[model samples]
Target chain A: MARTGQVKKVGTALAGVLTISLIAGVVFGEGTSPAAPAAPIPPVVAPAPFSPECQGGSTEIVTESPLPHVAAALMKRRTVRILAIGNSTGRRQGGFTRQIERLLKQVVKGADVVIINRGVSGELAANASLRIKNEVAMSNPDLVIWQVGTDDALAFVPLDEVRETVESTVRWLKEHNVDVVLAGLQYVERVAQDDNYYRTREMLRDVAAKEHVMIIRRYEAMQFIAAAQDAGGGYGPDEFERTEAGYNCLAQYLASAITVGAFGKGMSARPLRGPPGSQPQQPPQQAQPPQQQRPMQ
Target chain B: MPRQSNAIDFWRGIALITIFINHVPGIYYARFTHANYSLSDSADLFVFLAGWSLRYIVGVPDRPQQPIGYLVLRLGGRAVELYAAQILITMIAIAMLAATATILDNPLLLEWHNAAAVFYDPIFTHIGLAALTHHLGYFDILPLYVVLMAVAPVFAVIDRYAPNWLLPISIAIYLITLIVPLPIPTWPVEGQWFFNPLAWQLVFVLGFVMAREDGIGGFVRRHITVLRWLSVPIVAVSAYIVWNRMWPDPTLMPQPRLLFIADKTYVTPMRLIQFLALVALFSATYPYIKRWALRLVEFGSMLGRNSLIVFCVGSILSLAGQITRFVYRGDILVDTVVVVLGVAIMAFAAWLPEWREQVRLRRSAQPLPAS
Candidate 1:
């Protein structure tokens, strides 16, 4: 009798487990896969033309290599998701993330652009690297625009730690078939002479070159803009006001640079079609001769 | 200070102190925290202990369970309190940052710890803050606690009616979440919560389950020696992995990648498992700890007993510490001063209420001295 009761209890527990699993399965399994993406809508407005003040220093906008995955996704699916990580991406009015989305839509015509802005304020590169991996797993973004170096530089993090973290993370992203755009430190006039600041910038430049990824040379662009503004007249605005304008110009530059990187060899080879509102175009910027791809050790 | 100090409270106090130290990012002492050596940090202990404490609130074996409606209301009230606390402290933290920014004339202070949104997009960010959709870094855990508390009644109902089904149900939800990307998304910023409650609920449930006298609790107590022995290798190996920073790449894992990686956001299986093992291994050390460090044990217990308030004050103090460190350029001396002062204040914050309660108890026992 005792043995029979024990068997009956075990049977009951097994039945309960199966019932719960089935219920949970039915509920969660229904929406595990996202809805099939809608057909691409033709962009109604032309890509925002580069602000003339934001223009110039054409070399700063160069893409060293193509973002093959972004290009492929745009070709095949007509949709691409870009995860923007860093402290600086969260400027007042949706910052560069919104600008990129708008520019990509206008630039690519029918390609759908989704920018997942995962920027946290005061985040260093080493910390962002960890969060970037998980965000990649969850969001499955085709490209990541990492606004790195600024916080690390300010925090006085060692250059080697920054390099190792960025290099390893970039390699990891590449291995996972995701493209990366390293947006280097934001330029501030006061920090121009700081050794740590310069070292962080140099480190990022090195990582981008070493990893064979496109880098947004924000420092060089901002520096050029600052000099042009100063020569044109007095210091353009107070430090705070200039920071805001700097962010706007950064958005414009990044939109152009990222679009160029995505379209890559294709953009250079074809006769470029200018957006309706912009001047009849030359290729967005002087494209760097493509570097030979090297395998990461 | 509370007239009694127990192991759970002592451990909680230790976790609180660790959290306080870790929140000041550049503090030299931060390197010495359990996070440096363990896969699971104070967060795991804090959340697990939250679940363990929930067992007391819901019911005890010897005490009659409160009426179901009253129980639900109690949990709801607690959730409200936590929510209120989150809003209050977040506001104060922002104010502190803003004040520091103004005093120093450095606008960068406004950007620290995801506070830019609160200033930049105040209207939407305030709405997000109130709705618990936007959270600041290092100040996010409470929102998760509020959410877990809000759902406590369901766990209670399940435990009441089908006692055996609770853990299985929690596990099912956890597994389903692992397979499906069902994280609660953040708003006003397109992202997921830093602490995904769905994945984290399992640890809380495990804590609750293990705190009870029957089921898993009784089983654990009975075989604790053997389990402790088994946990030794998990703890030792995890320590080595963490110390060496041998964490695997999340993207390299197969589908349901979250399950394989040692991610804190999702409180992945590896973290959850290691946390449990660490708990198992450490749970036996209370007697030894009391023997050698009774003063430390008492201090930790006092802090643990008033965790919510201490945590709130500690959060503000840590933010202040961060600002101060930034201003001073964070040398050893700056870090030392920030840490020492911040922790000293936290201790006082914890002690203040207990002291008040003790006075109240003394007055009540004095048989209305004025009359």
Candidate 2:
């Protein structure tokens, strides 16, 4: 009797387990082989004309090689998805994320850029690192543009941990056949002198060099623009309202890099501001190429 | 302090402290919290302990003397109180963020945690916020707690009348909800609630059911020694999995990914299992708690005892901590001072209830004739 009761209990438990499995099989089995995607339709708006402001200056922020997947999609389907994450993407209204999309449509031929901005403001790198895999798996984007390092710098996350986390995350993206672009360290004036800010910016540059992934010099780009705009400038608040102009400028810069990097060749680093503290000697700027007209808004 | 550990209060206190640190997103000490090694953090402990407390207060389902209607009213009232508390905190958080932005001369602070809603679409977002569908970051958990509270009476009745069937039904609902998603969608945003009450109800129900001395609870008590030994390996492996970032990608998993992966939002199976194993190991440590540890536990107990109020104050304190960090251009010294002071305030908040009771007693003795 005792043996029979024990058998009965085990059998009951197995049935419950089996039931859960059977239901799961029905749910996932149907979802696994997704239907074939519809043929791509060309976007409604015309691609924006290229802006001279984006022509080239900082070769450091430009992509080194072609984004193979994006390039292929551009050639065949004319459709490409980009996931923009990290803290600064949606900080401003009419965010830079949308600006990047608008610019890409305006510039790239036979290209449709759909950007899904999952930027949670004030989120640290450690938290973002954990969420990125899921975001990528769900969307399967061709490129991930992460505006990183700002929150990590503010949070006092150890430099080593920040580098390790970013490297591992970038590695994970690569393994999963997604290209990553690291947009580093928003140039905030308050923390400009803080070691954490400067160290984190340097660490990202080093990570980019070692990992060989493209790292957008958002900090450098902003600093250079502010410096050029101000006769004597070095990372403090410039005469320009930082948020509105900064978002647009960063978008324009990234858009230009993506266009050239996807279709043409990598940009050469034009030295600017001469390594931070040195007296400004009119550091070579990306002067007008003459063929280009008004800068794309 | 010298007696057997009050496991619930001790753990609740621990959860409170951890929650405070975690809420201040960029604090240096936050990295050391339980989330570093485990899939679930203090939130899970908090909700679970809430369920346990309700059961502890109401007595076992089998021998309840109070009418079911009264029990329903009490729990429903608790839900109302929590709703009020949630709204109070949300409004305060918005004001705090707004003031921070003005004081710091950085309008960007208003953009943090979706506070732009207050400036742009306050009416629509406030509707959602009041309805408990929209939650700001660091101010989310209370709404989830309120939703859970609203359903406490049903849990009580089921646990009492059909104790054996209670867990099975709750688990079945949870499993189904995980696949189908919640019936109601969040507003001012087109996604589900961050802490979906449907899925999270399982842990809450689990805590309630397990707190009893009969049914599955009795079986666990009988086999606790064996279970504790088994849990050691489970906790150890789970810790390794999270600490090493060895999580399997949930998207790569089959349907019912909630069961296969570790996620915080839905309280997925992996997270639930890992949390349970950790609890199993720690629950047995009451007797093993040293005298020195008890005093610390006692402080935590004070906070835990008056959790609702302390938690309210703690939430505000967390936002304050964030603003202070931003303002101070934080370093180790700043982070240390804020964390130490923040915890000290929460402790004082916790002690106030008992302090009030003692004052009431003394007043009653001296002032009856005058009254």
Candidate 3:
């Protein structure tokens, strides 16, 4: 009985030691390392030329940010892998990934753009952050286009939770050498007056700025397009039909945004105006005249 | 005769209730569910108990003697029934979403829970939905259950003939899946199933092996006290891990990373092991629960007896609760009302069939004068 008691004590001590070791391993693990090392910045190049189908005259769809990995992949292997993720907005822009691939191919003269869409409907930012890790493990993309904020606004997820989840996920991605572009909310009629919606959008903008990544500023773009078309009397009776058109136009804008983000060089670190009266963080850069654009192939 | 309230049914009923609450994404009560603090949630309990319950149908000694072919046919029919239930609930859920969208004049409602394909790409989405390749989020588990039931006959065959081989074969398949990460892909929406059946089959097999009276199950029953004592730290540490949200980065992990992560879709080793420890620790609670609250035991057992119908009803009610929360902005009062009414409706759903069965039994037992 005494021997058995001694053996039991030994087993208990061993288990205690093992547990402590596990806790230590978890506390000071691989994730503690800082993301975004000081790698030399790639030289800027001309933004990929837009397709004739892309509209919204000279609107700066993406703010100035460096996509060094995408540029390196394009330069060395002539290939870039992109993952489009987030809420239902990822699905709303039909065939936008194909358009991005096509435009990049046209511009880079043999670029192989591989895009995978992993969008879940009505997913909040926190949940999407978890899924992003799983998908990155599986897909190994060089760039992640995250359409965010709208669902969180609608679901009333805490603003702090949104910020923390997005910031940490963005940092995690950067640490793993993946570039990110945050696509902000859509401009739906129902949420036009929602303070939470606007705040969530602004919060996302702040996240992009703090992270030093580009944001698509989708809400501002959509708002500009809506105001321009309405003033020009381009309305059919069906507003849903206009939403479809808006999504199509959004596709073009996203494709352009990806192009500018991947290849645009020497862009000042400033936001640009989409149309007159739309929000811009800096003095508007004059949009190149329509005549300057290359005609559609 | 079977007891009015058994551990299996009571625990299954508990799982059903927990699942109902958790399915409502942002409910006030959602924070109170086991998911908030445990590595394994009701889904694991539901699936494990499902495997445990199947031991009776697999021609064990305690079960009445039945031919293997009959058992196979019964299991096949059950698989078909689960398939039908899945299709029916999916149609109802879609209609609910569509109705809400039209009533609110909000197209975004149509986009909720991966229903965009059904609205925008109806032709292919319908085929995908019917084939069980397309599933709405929070409405997915039935497909996994269907697959498990479909394969149960094969498991039973192996278990009956070579009992020792069943677990090792299941573990081999699970390990292979984790290494290769060969998930069952979703159609019409380039993705994978939320609950990957290949990796999940191991849990089911474990539950089955532990339910039997020979080999593993008998050994476990004989040594349950020691196992329970050993499980305490595992359960405690896992709860701490979940509470503090200490998840390892999947990307930094070595190859065969699915084996290391705490992913629910693949049901990783951590989750599986923690869940088994949880089962070991909690397996002793039912008798105490019965002693303290007999009414609760009876209520849970009733719900467990008609688990399929209750689960289907609970799932639909949970979706409705989500919609309710969305409409009302999810305060404490709204959550209370949604959960209270939803659970009541689910209980009613469970009771109705049993009441009808009892009625039929009484009529059959009565002597007919004219006939």
Question: CA lDDT of A295 in candidate 3?
Answer: 10
Candidate whose TM-score is highest: 3
* Per-residue lDDT of candidate 2, residues A31-129 (tens digit): 434464432322222223323222223324443444556655665678778888777465333367777877777655456788766666567787788
Per-candidate RMSD vs. true structure? 14.5, 14.0, 13.5
Clashes of each: 0, 4, 0
TM-score of 3: 0.84
Candidate 3's DockQ is: 0.22
Question: Candidate 3 lDDT, tens digit per residue, A45-95?
Answer: 233322212233244555546676776676566678988788753332243
Query: Clashing residue pairs, candidate 2?
Result: A47-A105, A47-A106, A48-A106, A59-A269
lDDT of 2 at B246: 85
Docking class of 3: incorrect
Q: Where does the lowest 10-residue lDDT sum fall in candidate 3 chain B?
A: B56-65
Candidate 3 lDDT, tens digit per residue, B109-210? 776787877877788889989999888878888899999999999998887677799999999999999898788877777667778899999888888899
Expressed as tens digits, the lDDT of each residue in B201-223 for candidate 2 is: 88888888788888787888898
What is the C-alpha local distance difference test score of each model?
Answer: 0.74, 0.68, 0.73
Ranking by TM-score: 3, 1, 2
Between prediction 1 and prediction 3, the one with superior DockQ is: 1
TM-score to native of every candidate shown:
0.83, 0.77, 0.84
Clashing pairs in 1: none
Candidate 1 lDDT by residue in tens digits, B1-371 = 36589988889889898998887775678889989888899989999999998998888534547987899899999999999999999999989888987876666566667777787778988889999988887898899999999899888888877778999999999989888867787767565687889988998999999998878999999999999999999999999987886777677788778788878878989888889899999999999999999998989999999999999998888888877776667778988898889889989999999989889888777865554
